[model samples]
Target: KRYSSEKSHIQGTSKLALGIFDGMKKIHGMGARERLLLQIAVLLHDCGKYISMEKVAECSYNIIMSTEIIGLSNWEREVIADVVLYNTRDFDTFEIMKQRDGMDKRTYLLVAKLVAILRLANAMDRSHYQKIQGLRVVLRDTELQVILDSARDLTLEMGLLRRQSEFFKEIYGIYPVLKRKRNA
Candidate 1:
Protein backbone atom coordinates (compact mmCIF):
# COMPACT_ATOMS: atom_id res chain seq x y z
CA LYS A 1 0.00 0.00 0.00
CA ARG A 2 2.80 2.40 0.79
CA TYR A 3 4.48 1.61 -2.49
CA SER A 4 1.27 2.22 -4.36
CA SER A 5 0.77 5.52 -2.58
CA GLU A 6 4.29 6.59 -3.36
CA LYS A 7 3.87 5.66 -6.99
CA SER A 8 0.69 7.71 -7.25
CA HIS A 9 2.34 10.67 -5.56
CA ILE A 10 5.21 10.50 -7.99
CA GLN A 11 2.86 10.42 -10.92
CA GLY A 12 0.99 13.45 -9.64
CA THR A 13 4.21 15.33 -9.14
CA SER A 14 5.30 14.43 -12.66
CA LYS A 15 2.10 15.85 -14.02
CA LEU A 16 2.54 19.07 -12.08
CA ALA A 17 6.11 19.34 -13.32
CA LEU A 18 4.99 18.92 -16.88
CA GLY A 19 2.53 21.75 -16.52
CA ILE A 20 5.08 24.01 -14.86
CA PHE A 21 7.75 23.16 -17.43
CA ASP A 22 5.47 23.91 -20.28
CA GLY A 23 4.51 27.22 -18.77
CA MET A 24 8.14 28.06 -18.05
CA LYS A 25 9.15 27.23 -21.58
CA LYS A 26 6.49 29.45 -22.96
CA ILE A 27 7.27 32.24 -20.54
CA HIS A 28 11.07 32.18 -20.62
CA GLY A 29 11.98 30.20 -23.72
CA MET A 30 14.07 27.63 -21.85
CA GLY A 31 16.31 25.44 -23.99
CA ALA A 32 16.44 21.66 -24.09
CA ARG A 33 19.25 21.30 -21.58
CA GLU A 34 17.56 23.63 -19.11
CA ARG A 35 14.32 21.74 -19.49
CA LEU A 36 16.08 18.45 -18.81
CA LEU A 37 17.69 19.79 -15.64
CA LEU A 38 14.38 21.15 -14.48
CA GLN A 39 12.73 17.77 -15.00
CA ILE A 40 15.43 16.03 -12.99
CA ALA A 41 15.04 18.55 -10.21
CA VAL A 42 11.32 17.96 -10.11
CA LEU A 43 11.67 14.18 -10.00
CA LEU A 44 14.05 14.17 -7.08
CA HIS A 45 12.68 17.12 -5.11
CA ASP A 46 10.94 14.94 -2.53
CA CYS A 47 13.29 11.98 -2.47
CA GLY A 48 14.33 13.16 0.98
CA LYS A 49 10.89 12.23 2.27
CA TYR A 50 12.14 8.68 2.31
CA ILE A 51 14.20 9.54 5.33
CA SER A 52 12.93 10.80 8.69
CA MET A 53 10.41 13.61 8.40
CA GLU A 54 12.43 15.98 10.53
CA LYS A 55 15.46 15.90 8.27
CA VAL A 56 14.04 14.78 4.98
CA ALA A 57 15.91 17.44 3.04
CA GLU A 58 19.19 16.55 4.71
CA CYS A 59 18.59 12.89 4.12
CA SER A 60 17.89 13.58 0.46
CA TYR A 61 21.14 15.46 0.17
CA ASN A 62 23.00 12.61 1.87
CA ILE A 63 21.40 10.06 -0.44
CA ILE A 64 22.34 11.97 -3.54
CA MET A 65 25.82 12.62 -2.29
CA SER A 66 26.43 8.98 -1.38
CA THR A 67 24.59 7.18 -4.15
CA GLU A 68 25.29 7.26 -7.86
CA ILE A 69 22.12 7.88 -9.78
CA ILE A 70 22.72 7.02 -13.44
CA GLY A 71 23.18 9.94 -15.87
CA LEU A 72 24.11 12.37 -13.09
CA SER A 73 27.75 13.06 -12.34
CA ASN A 74 28.95 13.75 -8.81
CA TRP A 75 29.01 17.49 -9.39
CA GLU A 76 25.55 17.38 -10.92
CA ARG A 77 24.30 15.39 -7.94
CA GLU A 78 25.72 18.01 -5.62
CA VAL A 79 23.90 20.76 -7.47
CA ILE A 80 20.66 18.82 -7.32
CA ALA A 81 21.11 18.12 -3.65
CA ASP A 82 21.80 21.75 -2.96
CA VAL A 83 18.73 22.78 -4.86
CA VAL A 84 16.60 20.29 -2.97
CA LEU A 85 17.91 21.39 0.40
CA TYR A 86 17.41 25.03 -0.38
CA ASN A 87 13.86 24.50 -1.58
CA THR A 88 12.62 24.43 1.99
CA ARG A 89 10.84 27.66 2.94
CA ASP A 90 12.82 28.01 6.13
CA PHE A 91 15.95 28.90 4.18
CA ASP A 92 16.15 32.37 2.73
CA THR A 93 17.43 33.09 -0.76
CA PHE A 94 20.17 35.32 0.60
CA GLU A 95 21.50 32.43 2.64
CA ILE A 96 21.38 30.10 -0.30
CA MET A 97 23.00 32.72 -2.49
CA LYS A 98 25.76 33.13 0.04
CA GLN A 99 26.46 29.41 0.07
CA ARG A 100 26.40 29.35 -3.72
CA ASP A 101 28.80 32.29 -4.09
CA GLY A 102 31.80 29.99 -4.49
CA MET A 103 30.15 28.03 -7.28
CA ASP A 104 29.82 29.05 -10.91
CA LYS A 105 27.22 31.73 -11.43
CA ARG A 106 25.49 29.83 -14.20
CA THR A 107 25.23 26.71 -12.09
CA TYR A 108 23.83 28.67 -9.18
CA LEU A 109 21.23 30.30 -11.37
CA LEU A 110 20.25 26.99 -12.91
CA VAL A 111 19.91 25.30 -9.55
CA ALA A 112 17.88 28.19 -8.19
CA LYS A 113 15.55 28.12 -11.14
CA LEU A 114 15.04 24.38 -10.93
CA VAL A 115 14.49 24.54 -7.19
CA ALA A 116 11.81 27.15 -7.60
CA ILE A 117 9.91 25.07 -10.12
CA LEU A 118 10.36 21.90 -8.09
CA ARG A 119 9.10 23.61 -4.95
CA LEU A 120 5.97 24.74 -6.72
CA ALA A 121 5.41 21.31 -8.22
CA ASN A 122 5.81 19.56 -4.89
CA ALA A 123 3.38 21.90 -3.23
CA MET A 124 0.80 21.28 -5.91
CA ASP A 125 0.58 17.65 -4.83
CA ARG A 126 0.37 18.15 -1.08
CA SER A 127 -2.30 15.51 -0.69
CA HIS A 128 0.07 12.76 -1.83
CA TYR A 129 -2.95 10.91 -3.16
CA GLN A 130 -3.17 12.24 -6.73
CA LYS A 131 -6.32 14.15 -5.88
CA ILE A 132 -5.59 16.84 -8.43
CA GLN A 133 -7.00 15.52 -11.66
CA GLY A 134 -5.11 17.88 -13.92
CA LEU A 135 -3.54 21.32 -14.17
CA ARG A 136 -3.50 24.08 -16.72
CA VAL A 137 -0.80 26.69 -16.92
CA VAL A 138 -1.52 30.08 -18.40
CA LEU A 139 1.19 32.56 -19.10
CA ARG A 140 0.30 36.20 -18.96
CA ASP A 141 2.39 39.25 -19.66
CA THR A 142 3.05 39.92 -16.00
CA GLU A 143 1.86 36.86 -14.12
CA LEU A 144 1.47 33.09 -14.29
CA GLN A 145 -1.76 31.30 -13.51
CA VAL A 146 -2.21 27.72 -12.44
CA ILE A 147 -5.70 26.23 -12.70
CA LEU A 148 -6.16 23.13 -10.63
CA ASP A 149 -8.76 20.50 -11.39
CA SER A 150 -9.83 18.45 -8.41
CA ALA A 151 -12.87 16.52 -7.27
CA ARG A 152 -12.05 16.38 -3.59
CA ASP A 153 -12.84 18.90 -0.88
CA LEU A 154 -11.17 22.27 -1.29
CA THR A 155 -9.13 22.57 1.90
CA LEU A 156 -6.03 20.61 0.88
CA GLU A 157 -6.21 21.85 -2.66
CA MET A 158 -6.43 25.47 -1.57
CA GLY A 159 -3.54 25.06 0.81
CA LEU A 160 -1.30 23.53 -1.83
CA LEU A 161 -2.27 26.16 -4.37
CA ARG A 162 -1.41 28.97 -1.98
CA ARG A 163 1.95 27.44 -1.12
CA GLN A 164 2.81 26.82 -4.75
CA SER A 165 1.87 30.38 -5.63
CA GLU A 166 4.26 31.71 -3.04
CA PHE A 167 7.18 29.78 -4.49
CA PHE A 168 6.17 30.69 -8.00
CA LYS A 169 6.22 34.38 -7.16
CA GLU A 170 9.51 34.15 -5.33
CA ILE A 171 11.34 32.20 -8.02
CA TYR A 172 9.95 33.58 -11.23
CA GLY A 173 9.62 37.20 -10.22
CA ILE A 174 6.05 37.02 -11.37
CA TYR A 175 2.78 36.84 -9.53
CA PRO A 176 1.17 33.40 -9.34
CA VAL A 177 -2.59 33.23 -9.16
CA LEU A 178 -4.31 29.92 -8.64
CA LYS A 179 -7.96 29.30 -9.36
CA ARG A 180 -10.15 26.24 -9.26
CA LYS A 181 -11.71 24.96 -12.46
CA ARG A 182 -15.35 25.35 -11.75
CA ASN A 183 -17.71 22.95 -13.42
CA ALA A 184 -19.97 24.55 -15.98
Candidate 2:
Protein backbone atom coordinates (compact mmCIF):
# COMPACT_ATOMS: atom_id res chain seq x y z
CA LYS A 1 0.00 0.00 0.00
CA ARG A 2 2.74 2.41 0.85
CA TYR A 3 4.72 1.76 -2.29
CA SER A 4 1.93 0.99 -4.73
CA SER A 5 -0.84 3.34 -5.79
CA GLU A 6 -2.37 1.27 -8.56
CA LYS A 7 -4.12 -1.40 -6.56
CA SER A 8 -6.19 -2.92 -9.34
CA HIS A 9 -3.26 -3.79 -11.56
CA ILE A 10 -1.36 -5.33 -8.66
CA GLN A 11 -4.40 -7.27 -7.50
CA GLY A 12 -5.24 -8.44 -10.99
CA THR A 13 -1.68 -9.53 -11.63
CA SER A 14 -1.59 -11.43 -8.37
CA LYS A 15 -4.82 -13.20 -9.21
CA LEU A 16 -3.60 -14.16 -12.65
CA ALA A 17 -0.28 -15.36 -11.24
CA LEU A 18 -1.99 -17.42 -8.56
CA GLY A 19 -4.21 -19.01 -11.16
CA ILE A 20 -1.17 -19.85 -13.25
CA PHE A 21 0.79 -21.02 -10.23
CA ASP A 22 -1.98 -23.33 -9.11
CA GLY A 23 -2.30 -24.76 -12.59
CA MET A 24 1.42 -25.43 -12.79
CA LYS A 25 1.89 -26.61 -9.20
CA LYS A 26 1.84 -30.33 -9.79
CA ILE A 27 4.06 -30.18 -12.83
CA HIS A 28 6.74 -28.04 -11.14
CA GLY A 29 6.70 -29.41 -7.57
CA MET A 30 5.69 -26.02 -6.13
CA GLY A 31 3.43 -26.12 -3.11
CA ALA A 32 1.81 -23.81 -0.60
CA ARG A 33 5.00 -22.04 0.42
CA GLU A 34 5.91 -21.16 -3.13
CA ARG A 35 2.40 -19.92 -3.73
CA LEU A 36 2.70 -17.57 -0.77
CA LEU A 37 6.03 -16.30 -2.02
CA LEU A 38 4.70 -15.83 -5.52
CA GLN A 39 1.73 -13.90 -4.20
CA ILE A 40 4.01 -11.65 -2.20
CA ALA A 41 6.32 -11.17 -5.14
CA VAL A 42 3.50 -10.29 -7.52
CA LEU A 43 1.89 -7.93 -5.08
CA LEU A 44 5.08 -5.94 -4.63
CA HIS A 45 6.69 -6.41 -8.03
CA ASP A 46 5.58 -3.03 -9.34
CA CYS A 47 6.29 -1.01 -6.24
CA GLY A 48 9.56 0.13 -7.77
CA LYS A 49 7.58 2.19 -10.25
CA TYR A 50 6.65 4.31 -7.27
CA ILE A 51 10.18 5.68 -7.18
CA SER A 52 11.36 5.59 -10.76
CA MET A 53 9.54 4.43 -13.87
CA GLU A 54 12.85 4.05 -15.66
CA LYS A 55 14.27 1.76 -12.94
CA VAL A 56 11.20 0.10 -11.53
CA ALA A 57 12.69 -3.34 -11.54
CA GLU A 58 15.82 -2.30 -9.66
CA CYS A 59 13.94 -0.08 -7.23
CA SER A 60 11.40 -2.78 -6.61
CA TYR A 61 14.13 -5.29 -5.94
CA ASN A 62 15.84 -2.98 -3.48
CA ILE A 63 12.60 -2.15 -1.67
CA ILE A 64 11.68 -5.81 -1.31
CA MET A 65 15.15 -6.81 -0.14
CA SER A 66 15.35 -3.96 2.36
CA THR A 67 11.97 -4.36 4.00
CA GLU A 68 11.50 -7.07 6.58
CA ILE A 69 8.58 -9.35 5.99
CA ILE A 70 8.03 -11.69 8.90
CA GLY A 71 7.87 -15.43 8.20
CA LEU A 72 10.05 -14.93 5.13
CA SER A 73 13.71 -15.71 5.53
CA ASN A 74 16.54 -13.88 3.81
CA TRP A 75 16.71 -16.50 1.09
CA GLU A 76 12.99 -16.25 0.54
CA ARG A 77 13.31 -12.47 0.33
CA GLU A 78 16.00 -12.94 -2.28
CA VAL A 79 13.67 -15.17 -4.23
CA ILE A 80 10.99 -12.52 -4.15
CA ALA A 81 13.55 -9.83 -5.02
CA ASP A 82 14.85 -11.80 -7.96
CA VAL A 83 11.31 -12.41 -9.12
CA VAL A 84 10.63 -8.68 -9.01
CA LEU A 85 13.94 -7.69 -10.53
CA TYR A 86 13.58 -9.94 -13.53
CA ASN A 87 9.86 -9.39 -13.88
CA THR A 88 10.59 -6.88 -16.64
CA ARG A 89 14.34 -6.97 -17.24
CA ASP A 90 16.08 -9.34 -19.59
CA PHE A 91 17.35 -12.41 -17.77
CA ASP A 92 21.02 -13.38 -17.66
CA THR A 93 21.91 -16.88 -16.53
CA PHE A 94 25.52 -16.17 -15.65
CA GLU A 95 24.66 -12.99 -13.76
CA ILE A 96 21.98 -14.74 -11.72
CA MET A 97 24.37 -17.58 -10.87
CA LYS A 98 26.99 -15.12 -9.65
CA GLN A 99 24.58 -12.96 -7.63
CA ARG A 100 22.92 -15.80 -5.78
CA ASP A 101 25.56 -16.76 -3.27
CA GLY A 102 23.92 -19.46 -1.14
CA MET A 103 20.94 -20.24 -3.30
CA ASP A 104 21.05 -23.88 -4.26
CA LYS A 105 20.21 -25.21 -7.69
CA ARG A 106 16.68 -26.15 -6.61
CA THR A 107 15.99 -22.74 -5.12
CA TYR A 108 17.38 -21.01 -8.20
CA LEU A 109 15.07 -23.07 -10.33
CA LEU A 110 12.17 -22.10 -8.08
CA VAL A 111 13.00 -18.41 -8.54
CA ALA A 112 13.09 -18.87 -12.29
CA LYS A 113 9.72 -20.55 -12.25
CA LEU A 114 8.17 -17.79 -10.17
CA VAL A 115 9.75 -15.09 -12.35
CA ALA A 116 8.33 -16.77 -15.44
CA ILE A 117 4.83 -16.74 -13.97
CA LEU A 118 5.15 -13.15 -12.78
CA ARG A 119 6.42 -12.01 -16.17
CA LEU A 120 3.37 -13.49 -17.88
CA ALA A 121 1.03 -11.95 -15.33
CA ASN A 122 2.70 -8.54 -15.69
CA ALA A 123 2.47 -8.68 -19.47
CA MET A 124 -1.22 -9.50 -19.22
CA ASP A 125 -1.71 -6.24 -17.35
CA ARG A 126 0.93 -4.27 -19.24
CA SER A 127 -1.48 -1.50 -20.12
CA HIS A 128 -2.64 -1.26 -16.52
CA TYR A 129 -6.19 -1.45 -17.87
CA GLN A 130 -6.85 -4.99 -16.68
CA LYS A 131 -8.48 -6.14 -19.92
CA ILE A 132 -8.29 -9.75 -18.80
CA GLN A 133 -11.71 -10.67 -17.46
CA GLY A 134 -10.91 -14.28 -16.67
CA LEU A 135 -7.89 -16.57 -16.89
CA ARG A 136 -7.90 -20.30 -17.48
CA VAL A 137 -4.81 -22.45 -17.55
CA VAL A 138 -4.70 -25.68 -19.48
CA LEU A 139 -1.62 -27.88 -19.62
CA ARG A 140 -0.90 -30.17 -22.50
CA ASP A 141 1.90 -32.67 -23.01
CA THR A 142 4.06 -30.12 -24.84
CA GLU A 143 2.42 -26.77 -24.28
CA LEU A 144 0.84 -24.79 -21.50
CA GLN A 145 -2.15 -22.84 -22.71
CA VAL A 146 -3.44 -19.67 -21.07
CA ILE A 147 -6.96 -18.95 -22.27
CA LEU A 148 -8.04 -15.38 -21.54
CA ASP A 149 -11.70 -14.41 -21.55
CA SER A 150 -12.20 -10.79 -22.47
CA ALA A 151 -14.28 -8.61 -24.73
CA ARG A 152 -11.61 -5.95 -25.23
CA ASP A 153 -8.86 -6.06 -27.84
CA LEU A 154 -5.65 -7.63 -26.58
CA THR A 155 -3.14 -7.10 -29.34
CA LEU A 156 -0.63 -5.39 -27.03
CA GLU A 157 -0.98 -7.97 -24.31
CA MET A 158 -0.65 -10.81 -26.80
CA GLY A 159 2.48 -9.30 -28.28
CA LEU A 160 4.12 -8.86 -24.86
CA LEU A 161 3.11 -12.36 -23.87
CA ARG A 162 4.76 -13.70 -26.99
CA ARG A 163 8.01 -12.03 -25.95
CA GLN A 164 7.75 -13.27 -22.36
CA SER A 165 6.76 -16.82 -23.34
CA GLU A 166 10.31 -17.66 -24.34
CA PHE A 167 11.56 -17.30 -20.75
CA PHE A 168 8.64 -19.37 -19.55
CA LYS A 169 9.57 -22.09 -21.99
CA GLU A 170 13.20 -21.90 -20.96
CA ILE A 171 12.31 -22.35 -17.32
CA TYR A 172 9.53 -24.94 -17.59
CA GLY A 173 10.59 -26.81 -20.70
CA ILE A 174 7.03 -26.35 -21.98
CA TYR A 175 5.99 -23.56 -24.28
CA PRO A 176 3.24 -21.26 -23.02
CA VAL A 177 0.65 -20.33 -25.60
CA LEU A 178 -1.80 -17.49 -25.03
CA LYS A 179 -5.29 -17.99 -26.39
CA ARG A 180 -7.94 -15.31 -26.15
CA LYS A 181 -11.70 -15.90 -26.39
CA ARG A 182 -14.60 -13.52 -26.36
CA ASN A 183 -16.37 -13.23 -23.06
CA ALA A 184 -19.79 -14.82 -22.86
TM-score of each: 0.82, 0.93
**Consecutive 10-residue window with the lowest summed lDDT within model 1:** 1-10
Query: C-alpha displacement of 50 in model 2, angstroms?
Result: 2.2
Model 1 TM-score, all chains together: 0.82
lDDT (Cα) of model 2: 0.88
lDDT of 1 by residue, 14-87 (tens): 78876878876856556776666666655666677776678777877777677787887776777777777776
Candidate 2 on 118-145: residue-level lDDT in tens?
9999999899898988888999998999
What clash pairs does model 1 have?
none
Runs of candidate 1 with Cα error greater than 4 angstroms are 1-5, 92-101
RMSD of each: 3.0, 1.6
